[model samples]
Target: MSGGDARQISVRTKDRNSEERSEQLAPPLRRDQSDSITYRSFLRVRAYAVMTKPRVMELLLVTTVPTMILAHGGPPNLPLIVATLMGGAASSGSASAFNMYLDRDMDAQMRRTSGRPLVTGEVAPRSGLLFAWILAVSSTVWFWCLVNYLAAALSVCAILWYVVVYTILLKRRTEQNIVWGGIAGCFPVVIGWASATGTVSWPAVILFLVIFFWTPAHYWPLSVKYGEDYRRVGVPMLGAIHGIEHVAKRVIAYAVATATASLLLIPVAGMSWTYATVAVVGGAWFVGEGLRLQAAARRAEAAARPMRMFVVSNAYLALLFAAVAIDTLVKHRFS
Candidate 1:
């Protein structure tokens, strides 16, 4: 480069850096502004994080890890596990962010979601949509490079299924939104299994079915609790469309199916006594909670029973997956 041109470029770079430093060193916000720009930036980042739905991703990771262990017949390579989970998080987060963007209108109307980033104006819609697409593409590439092609494809399908199928097509239109739409949530099992073995096996299918059956049992109670919020937003959640009694009945039916599916994993996967015991006992407790909620619904009682059922269902899945991991490790260690 010519000397004059190089000098101009250097001056521009220095000026940019100097401006950044000045901004960093600037005194607290002016008395009129009340809040610093830096603090507002931090909150914007946090709001973006909230758009990812961390709690749902945590439960997804819980299922993914155990399924990977079962697929490997023990704990898999630490680095591979980490890479797969990172990709999974990115995929799920992208789907959630897109859902937030698409549902922001309804979210604004619902009390439960009124404070969501887009709804609250904490994150711009365009930015949220761009973030979602970026994560979606990056996660697919991440899985293909770090895990396997099959895992990557499944991860992409998961995001597509949740965002396109569920969020766009099903959520607002049907009461069975979560029933079939919940299939996206169950893909992590097959993705984890494929990551470990590079193939989907019967064991993985069984676990997938377990999650599929468990979804209604686990989520319907929360739907019952949030029926009014959903109704207010014109979202057709089961508990919003039908009364709590009908929701409770379906919850009991799905609970029974979930319990049966959990037990079937023992025979199909040859899971050990630890898993068997936990599956049976945990399944029973989960169903009992469902029954309690059903009875309350039948009697036209308050919402407490359904809420209790929701809490127990979380514990139920956690314990069952925990037992899967523990049992796999125990047998692998002893053998």
Candidate 2:
């Protein structure tokens, strides 16, 4: 072979090697493909969040922080509070995910729940179950290691009560489902108090009972709004089986019970004027909303606005707990 031919071959081989190196250095995906992957990842994360039922978790956490504050007589340890909240949130998420998985069939038939991640096929059933288990185990472990064993045990119990007792056993079986199943929602207050004090106290018990009574009042109005949804799904929520008047009457009884429980906390906790005022005023307003609901039901059942009571119930709880925390903080500051 000639010298030129040898040189040309060497140059071609070097060029080919350099091209391969450049190819290897290039990004695996194009910009559009990377964007697509990122969007999919965001969607997956959102789907998982939806499975956790963030709104319900928000209400649970609302009760938790104030109870912790009241238990500590002020702000609790920041790290402890954060850890407890995180674990509680995870536990709640796990239970809600489990509920979505278990009730996917019913949810598909209900308008209110039709948009859930499970019902909408945003998350696979098996994947959701696995996520639930992961959350349940991880949350329990997180509580055990970061918080205390009492909190951990409570976390586990909350999950089991919500999933097994409420979702599995009661939800499909009776119109009184929420009356019993709502027990799970009240666990946060006790767990919060336990996390702060290491034992449940009278105040905690009273607060728990407050939630116990408040649950039916809070949820029954919502059930009234979604009565048809529950009926279609074969879930015998109170409003589904009972007449609006009957449901409204029950709501009034529970509302009065909730208000009475709130007042009990003032004496039991020795809460100050701030709490006293809020409790009396808030409780009256709450009961009044229930009364309004009942009157509306009596005047024209078709025109009754149960959702008005539902909104009021939420505001009432938030205000009551806020008063609890504020009263503690104010007293602590003055002292």
Candidate 3:
């Protein structure tokens, strides 16, 4: 009786083990299954990243590093550097994603924007907003812990300025949208400056002003070319509302202001003579290009000329900052 019972129990145990092994061989997320847990999770993450505006983050982070180098008077605090970068990235990224969420309807209307991941249904709007919220909260906490309160506060201001004020309010309301909204991009400089000193300074304010003045001209040329799209979408862009020719005049005016501001920044930055030279050459050239674009817009011929002006304006900003950085380093070493 005992032997018979023991044999039956042994067979049952072996069967159970075989079933367990078979289950193990069947992966939780099958490679061939498109609906597998891993694949869906990855797509969700990728879509979220796309919404966060990587290009904007690239430029913003670039600004932070230079500010750090200049602020420390040489080698920066390594931990502060990493923390500041993470905070800046997360804050900017969150704002960008939120913008996608807010502008989903407008994006669907414009041909240029209709193909965005959110508008195209590549990413669900809810998921995009959730991602933005998570990132923004986490980033604020991160900066608060790593940097001082001033830096964290500045980051929050940047997010609010871009998402709420610029994207929601200004973008639809007035052509002067970029004029007031450009403050979003200007925050990184202030945040970077504050990260070093933990307080806003006149130099940082000057940097803010320079970027602010540069923004309208920077944007208007593109707006002029895309005025039709903007009009179709019911966006009150300068070019669309005021007319391209008139907007072109404003573009030149902004460029004139920006060039003047660029020259002014050399002294305000407490920088050397080399920076002064870049300002003189860069500013003059910048103004000349603006005038050319203004005339081109008036002629109503090849719009390509105005487009070139836009490209040159971008080059001017990037190079101007780089020159300032290099010149400061050089002069410091020699002096």
Q: lDDT tens digits, residues 211-299, model 3?
A: 78888888887787777789988998786677556766787787778777767666666777777787778878788887776676677
Q: Estimate each model's TM-score.
A: 0.89, 0.89, 0.84
Q: List the residue pairs that clash in candidate 1.
A: none
Clashing residue pairs found in predicted model 3: none
Kindly list the per-residue Cα lDDT of model 2 for residues 186-251, writing each as its tens digit. Answer: 999999998999899999999999999999999998898888999898889999888888998999
TM-score of 2: 0.89
The reply for model 1, stretches above 4 Å from the true place, is 1-34
Candidate number achieving the greatest lDDT relative to the actual structure:
2
- lDDT, model 2, position 210: 93
Runs in model 3 lying further than 4 Å from the true structure: 1-43
Please give the distance, in angstroms, between residue 235's alpha carbon in candidate 3 and its true position after superposition.
0.6
Better of 1 and 3 by TM-score: 1
**Clashes (N, CA, C under 3 Å) per candidate:** 0, 0, 0
* Higher-ranked by lDDT: 1 or 3: 1
Candidate 3: residue 304 lDDT (0-100)? 35
Give candidates' CA RMSD values in order. 12.5, 8.6, 9.8
